[model samples]
Target: MRYMSHLLPLSRVARLVGQPRSTIQRMIHDGELDTFDGMVDMNELLRVFPDVRWEDDGEFRRVEEIKEKAFARRVYERALPGKEVLAERLHELGREFAAAKSLLLHYDRVHRFLDDKLDDLAERAGVDAVATLRHWLRTELEAAPDEAARAEALLAQESVMRIMSATVTVRPSGHEFFVEGNDTILEAALRAGIPLNYGCSNGNCGECRARLLSGQVSKSHPHDYVLKESEKADGVILMCSYTAVSDVVVEAGVAGAEDIPVQRVQTRVKAVERLNEHMVALRLTTPRSRRLRFLAGQHVTASIGGDAGEYHVASCPCDDRQLTLHVRRDNRPFARRVFEDLRKEDTVDIEGPGGRFVFSLESRRSPVFIAWEDGFAPIKSLIEHAMSLEISEAMHLYWIAAAVDAGGADHYRDNLCRSWADAYDNFFYTPLSADDGLATLVERVLAAHANLSRVDLYVAAPRPLLDAIREAALARGLALRGWHGEVIEPFPGAPATG
Candidate 1:
């Protein structure tokens, strides 16, 4: 017997099955699962994940526990949708349930009418064939279909998901993310590592405006900027002020490195964490009204107490309001200031998030990162961004630093790297000593991969080593465009070596 088809977006399907989006995509790629117009049929989802217990609350609880532990108290609270948005979402879901119930009631009435007609015909015709047909219809109607229980459970779980989050799809870029808790479209996009253009996240600037293509959204926050009447009639909305009530398609521009204008933000020092004797992690928190926007692997000029220096951001852009930079003990005035006297709550002026050494958003190839000495700063940012993006390709990291006792650039965040490797099945970490001559280190790294053509390699090192690795990698079949290198000077006055 044929059943009604319920189509779900891939993101929702992944959540329902308790799997990563990449896993679902892989299933589709391998022909293990089927999709129509990028959506999975409910029956197809049931067929592929037969063992899933949609009625079980185990998965839901597990996820909640992880979030509770992973995020700070304030952050966890912020992740929840505002009461206004939550109420609207619930109201929308109720309307859907009401409509479905009405349709079911109509179908029941039709079934009864057909049954009465069958009886009338049987009584009038007085034929054995008519009686048999009537009996068959009654049996089929009275008995439950084999998939009834599973289908009901699926619907129940989906209702909960709808109440908790909504999916959003950006046109042109085709990036998808869940609007969970109380996030506006812009907030969710940034958290998902999709760098959509925006300025003054509180809605003073009209930079985050986009045209809504489908689905419903409620204004979760008020904005001072007014939309033109024509623009409003054309379905234009400011992403920062609107919360999606259902799966939505929007026409918004995804900003590239060049597309992101330089932003000057006044930030306050949150903390100064000494990673090791040689390096300190400067944590700065931006004002609630304005956050600095920059891509992974980008460097920003930060000035504190009249001393300014350029440093690669060590934190992910997904880290809202907070920015972290790694500074080494050197003669640079800014570096010295951070080590000598920078304290909590001190004001820092940040400007010009310059440099093009950023993640290649378009590529799905496995990323191989090589960091020399203190060059791990940018590499760390890129890895975190990759994790946030949830890329399916395997990631390999190589940190070449001196031994802790040797006093060279030690792996200050070694434990953090180890935790990532332990947590993710697709992430791999390898730490090598700089003592292993640059040539030998290159050979060792190259030997790990038999084929380099399919991988995107990012290297951060002094110019000489960077050029050497690039030449060797290209000769070994690495795509020329896939090579990204950033020069790391040993000290402030050192001449850049090519």
Candidate 2:
């Protein structure tokens, strides 16, 4: 399940696609992307995105907010039942929903979901104000007819038209720029040397996204998307949208970058050696011969021809002068070029020491429970970092590999943990045969560590395995939120698993 990779951080990828982190994980699991090495690049992202170019279109999306002045007024007015009666109904609704998680799960009608949720709650609680709400809205909404009329007039304002513009802003590095006439924020940001977080340019991801600082705007935000009340609370806006209003200032974060730290950089193919029958070690030497500065567990990105990808630094962390990556060939993406055509003398591009997986012995909190399902690269790097930081926590790695290659798991465990002799806690890899079949393995992990109280668990694997681990951990009363993972998921895809 592992492959040689290019170094593209999960965050930037998420931003580019306008999706939460979990969605990308699911896509990778479902094998919906082109994973050259272990990373998918801009070219690949756009290729997979069927209508990426449409993001550049100037025609505004059909959202109620296109005339937001009146629309918000309408919503605000409708939401305003008599304050006393509204409060009474809201209180009753709370009690009903609190007791009826079952009923909430079954409600299916979409357009009337809000009405259903609230109405069900009112009827269950036998609240009389529920009926009053209709009469109250009928009476109140009439007062906003003039405001709606005014909004209709203002929405047709000719001074405004959503034109595409690229915007870039760099952080911690202090770089910033804006595209004057171009409406493509992704293009503008990249053109200007700004790295803002973005995944899908189609407004599906909330990453290359930013806040609309000044001008008013509108989009199909009604479709359930990433920006929640908190992120939007700070004036956050998506960079992908053709602005409902142009001439707006955007506070750029790294996902929306003028130059993704992952873009091409010249690197030399230092060497290629065998790690095992299934894995090969590929060494890359940067052309400048200077050490690439990066935090301990971050990865690097590389590409070949006009289309290269990224992967983690498989070599020791202390040495950034040259890069080492482990390539695991897959049946789908066989590595013919990298192994056969690539040469030692030629230069290649590797950008980043990417990813947020880092370790420090400076603050030892508890024993480290490290689990890697084909995620050996980052997990391996982190374990090394923990050793370097002189962390006192007892570390355990439940590393997974094919059953036969289990004996060869060495390089990572030297002077590392309770056991130097390689009797590692190895988990058998089984093909998922049916539903609830593999949940047993995850349950076993928790059962053994029942007293693993206060442990920091780091899990990296396929989406299904991760989901099983999450469910098991929660079942065993593992307080995940405090130790909650930085992973993302597309909940809509959850039901599709069956």
Candidate 3:
């Protein structure tokens, strides 16, 4: 009787039920229909659609049932030769599942026992038990990789070192930068302050594509951009995904004048003001001789007590030796230490004046500044710089706060910018709350700037907001080139525990 049970494809069921194939697929996907290897049992279909007459089309259902039985019989007869093989495979899978279950159960038991032990240890050590266990487990797990991977790692390291210790020199610009191990040519160049024309740095756009004049380079990563056979023959390489295996010369154009040099400066914190609950406005004064020269919208790496973090300069370059950074307090030890322990006259090391995320000095187009959270730091710098440059182009600032209270003062700088807007003919300011969701905020911003194609957009936000705005802008026909400045600082890692 079971052998006579008709099994039908989803398509066949959809055709018989007069429903869309997608509807049938959805039914199966949602567990409304039982499917085995893409075939549904006839009895199951009848249970699902009882109103349908099985014999409406001249005993078609019975004919399908007979065909299914014959197909099953044929499969059985064909499988007779490899019946032992099928049984053995099934047995192996059963044993594997059993083993996995046993292993997981054993681990659960061990974990519970460890938790008890950790509780006792935590009582003695005066630390949270789960956190203590997590630390130990992470340390042990990290160590586990070292012993198991040492031999293979040593072999791999040698091979990588041999090929990765290469330099790439760009033509015309004559800017020379050494490509770091495991870094793409563009990443290395960007890190070393060698500005290369790039958009969507992950190789979606071919803006970073360069022609190799001599030496060897290979694709170190995947890219969606296709290269023609002729272009390949001409030695064109996407620097965003390529790694040099030898000292190579490439025909890559530099973004701007290479006169700006990144420098390390030792500065003393002049003051730290609480900008909000989570943010601090840090002012640092460098020595007269060591004053940093940087373009607005650039960021700097600040190091103190062995912990370092990159922060965008919030102050304009015209402000001289003093650098202002909006430091957001988070899980990072450096940030917490800065907020709680850092004080006036505290010395810190600063690296950079890096990044090509600067305003197009020559562009007369209206400028739009979009910032979320502490992203206002870089945008603030850019606005000040633009005003100082006496650029008469209309400027707009959009402040997107996470919440009403999140900005510390209900959009602290929003009112200030609004006041500036009231005073200046070309300046405009708008404040938005994330209460409406990012999608709505993006729509509102887009609606405000209907001509996105003609404006220079300087977006300073976290990756999620940046990605959302970029996608929204692209969807609205905004040219990728219209995006000028960006300063993104990702979420900080957990604080180091003693």
Candidate 4:
């Protein structure tokens, strides 16, 4: 589905709402908002966030000013026939501008040189005017090489001739950006001043993944991230890693208002309670006016004493001012400080709402959440958000983790899972230990489910485990469309693989 669009980038829209650019990007990807040439429509923005005060509020006054300027520019541009027509007109105008300037400069230089020669010849030659004229013409001819060099240099300095080897048209937005012969799609979009949703600027994160609706593209770099076979068949390409070999049509989505903008907030440690020997619950409170607004399953980076690390938010979005995270004790600097030195009322820097592991609020499919150890943090948030929506579809959670201690058979927060399952008619929970082979467990669980393809599966685990389960599920005829997962960073003390 497509929505009406304006020419304002997502950043401007995010700035108006005091949110992160990623929030708006997520909305577009989730089909909540529409964009044209990387911009959102004003009417659509007002419709999406009707609560925003445009008439009386000081912030919105600035937004209105921006809107007026943008609309005026759009009106002037729309007077032209079309983008291609405008592009051709601009190319012609540019050539004319360059040619005119070059002509003036060339004439001025030649005239000065000839004028000096004529003055010199007039003074030197008394009677032979034709001879003097001949001498001057010879001098001008001799300087031709120098004139040619100057003209070449001037033309080189002008970027009026852009040889676009390929053009990328993103649809159904009707936005077009050009690609240089040697540049990747992401680089070309950025160079052409086109806004695209991306992260890391490398292929490892898969944040810039998009579908190639037509044309050819080739890999330009090696990416550590793996793409599923189904995704390949659907023409998915990592924008950061692929260069267009021909005029390509790609489909990339934009985000919406429900995605809370990410920001750096000053938070005070409200409490830190040890959940177990290896895990702790960290609660934080942000300033009243600067509270965070994030979707469930998003992450935040906590920084203190020159240390920072990303952790998933374990709390629900309903509790905006207050934050919660489940931290696993590790040798990493951030975790070490949180475990040994962190205290209540201590100030900390929290930057967040990162990651796209968010729950799709619009999806009606039954959700199956899978988590490994403390990776359950985001899953907890997702479950709470799903409950808040009062969704009618059944939701199930399968938590797999190492036993807390030797000879201990219980999983992390087993009692809570059992309580939730008992309390809610639509919710179910299963706890599994890592000792149970991942493949075996996945097979058993998937077999228990009736429609594997119709379920929305969200997983949070180490990359290897997530990959294993994904392959196993696919083998069981699970659809790849609704799969989502967060790759947990390895612990500091874990064995390093070369």
Candidate 5:
């Protein structure tokens, strides 16, 4: 392999070093592995694989580097006679003292070595070769101290060090700045004097979401809450999970992390059959290790091939390990590729394991209020999660939906409805088209359940209903906070406004 010097694929090198393939590719783009073009194979990668692992993908190396640089900056600050400069920091941070460093030897082993040589050659040797210049220098003068110093200074001055850098765009808040760059977007933002909004810098908190109007960014952490492919093309990104891959522009308003939950890839579409003219009951499957972790009634954004706005996850956050999503297709909204044409084995991109609608038996209230409409997707998850925790207290549920068709493979609803009817306080059903049945969403739940905010009130339905029920509960002076509702499209931006 060493003798061949070429032909090694990057995936193989990634395996040898125990890293993700994406990491290896990022390092190459960051100029860390600038030795090759795009692909790194047997001979080419083997050359640099020994000393460095995955440069972009390395968690430990990045942190340590940040620490070392911080130390260097501190030393630079103390050593400065007056104003601090980056050069002063570099000089103070030298690990070894004055060891006659050779410029040729220093640049030879780096990925940028060849590129530097070519660029410098273009400027100095476009018409004359270095050999001819050296011959002239030897004949013209002997080794002069001033000339040698001048030559070394020029060479040193022309060297490029920083590889992945970021810029910033200040948001309307004026206090917070949106970060964009190729490698470390947030890091670069901090360097540029921007107060980047962050809570739990890890990808778990969906606080760092921002729109990238231009340029590219890479994830600083591995993430399951990936934006839809269409959203990516449209420039929406999760700042926490992304490291700018190139120069980028964005809206930098940090959505409060506590308000959002990170979506994890837990299951696949196991069963899909129609429940009504506009609804489909989807049973999703998942492995034990990748089980979902979320509260009941919380929902997720589900998309195929990254087209966001496909649909929302109707699953219990508590039972997320092996999750479920009951999709009531607005035939109009998901009429295209993601929902209608999506099939088994197709990858689904999800975001938001969100919504505050949860029923905790621990509360003084025994019965949790559940308003189910259109379908069983969202409501079933909440009920199941509540029962899993043995909240034996009655679940006073008002199942509100239109069963427009009985022949459209609506068999799944029978088992789901029967399973919970015997287990809780009361199961109320209402038909959408019927005059007496569908009109009283908030009114019905209020009639049967207590009005105190202490009672967990859950509403999962169309956006119109969600807003109506939410407003009614709050207007009654019953602190209807901790309200959890499931909507179809992701509420754009990190702001709590939407």
Candidate 6:
């Protein structure tokens, strides 16, 4: 029997089947699953995963828990769509349900008319064949479809997904993310680690405007930036003020390192965490209206009490409202202040997210990140961003720490790296001791990679070590474009390591 075709976005399909988006994309690449215009058909999903019980899927339980307990009020509120958006989404779903029901009613009438015609023919001509035909039609109509229960479960799951979130696809970049909770398009995009161009996220700058290609959206927030009538007719909307009501496609530019303008934000000191005697993790929180916008692996200049220092941001861009920087103990004024005087709630001015050593957005190659001592800060940011992007390729991280007695850094966040390795099947972490010298350490790193041609290498170390890794990697057929290196110089009066 033919089944109605219901298409789901790739992200939604991944969520429904309890798989990572990368895993689903890999299946598509390997021809294990088929899609139509990048969307998976409900029938196709069922056929590909015949053993899956949709009714018993974890997503159903999650939705149920959300409804029953209002689980984690803060998280629940953040994950739910606003009332206006919820109403529109429900209205849209209702329209679809009504259409399907109307079609079923129409089909029922047709079946009755055909039955009457068959009865008339049988009576008029005493035709046994017409009687048999009518009986066969009635039998087929009355019998349950083989996939009835599973289809019903799938539909129920899909309805819940639609009500909870809507997928948004950016045209030129082809980045996709779900708009969940009360988040506007811009908020969702930032949270997903897709660096779409925007300024003043509260909707004053009009930098977040995009042309809608399809699907429905509701104005979730008021914007002072007015769209010209012609632009409105062309379906332009401010991403900061609109909430997606259905899966939507919009044309927008994805920002690169050069495209982002430098802005100084006054941030409050959230915490001063001492990772070790030599290093401290400075955590800062920006105001809700003015979050620092920077790609992962970039550096920002932070100032407190008239003392400033340039440090690489150690936090992922997906981490909203928070910025983390690793500061090593040194004679530098900024470092001294952090260790001696910086306190929670103290204001620190952040400026210039300067550096080209950001993640390569288009590289599908496996990423190999090598960090030397304190250089791990930027590498940490890159890894988290890659995680947020959900890259399908396996990732390898090598951190070379110095012995404490030698005045070198230790793996301060070693547990966090281990947790990531434990959480992701595709992630691998390796810690090496720099006591063996850079030559031997580099050799070990190179030896582990049998095929360098298919991997992107990102190294953060002193200039000498950075060059050594880059030269060795390139000699092994690693593409020049695939190499990203940052020279991490030691602070004044600090021992030279790495």
**Candidate of highest lDDT:** 6
**lDDT tens per residue, model 4, 1-498:** 222232344544554555545456667868888876566776566557656433343334434554567547654332222334335435655775698789879978987787677777776775478566767666765565533443343232222212124557776654455555455787666544344556555678787889999877777666888999999999999998887655578997533323345788889999998887778889999886466656678898998868888889998765646789888887678888889999999988999778888876556578999887777889998888776544557889998776656322135577888898997777999887666676676776687787777788899877877887788777776777778878976433332111
| Per-residue error (Å), model 6, residue 328 | 1.2
- Backbone clashes in each candidate structure, one number apiece? 4, 59, 0, 12, 25, 2
Tens digit of per-residue lDDT, candidate 3, span 115-148: 6777777777877756766687757645644323
The top-ranked prediction according to TM-score is: 6
**Cα lDDT of model 6 by residue, 286-314, tens digit:** 99888999999999999986899999999
Tell me the lDDT of model 5 at 159. 19
Ranked by lDDT, the better of candidates 2 and 3 is 3
TM-score of 6: 0.94
lDDT of each: 0.87, 0.47, 0.69, 0.68, 0.47, 0.90
Please provide the root mean square deviation of candidate 6 (C-alpha atoms, Å): 2.4
Comparing candidate 1 with candidate 5, which one achieves the higher TM-score? 1
Candidate 2 lDDT over 346-411, as tens digits, reads: 666677756664543223344344333325566655555443322334455554333324432233
Model 3 clash tally, residue pairs: 0
TM-score of each: 0.91, 0.38, 0.46, 0.48, 0.39, 0.94
TM-score quality measure for candidate 1? 0.91
**Worst 10-residue stretch by lDDT in candidate 2?**
489-498
Q: Rank by TM-score, descending?
A: 6, 1, 4, 3, 5, 2
Name the regions of candidate 5 deviating beyond 4 angstroms: 1-267, 287-289, 310-312, 317-320, 331-341, 360-362, 368-372, 403-415, 424-434, 437-442, 450-454, 467-477, 481-498
Runs of candidate 4 exceeding 4 Å displacement: 1-260, 406-410, 490-498
Give the alpha carbon lDDT tens digit for every residue of 400-463 in model 1: 8875456566888999999999988889999987777878888999889888999999999998
Q: Report the error of model 1 at residue 318, Å.
A: 0.6
RMSD of 1: 3.3
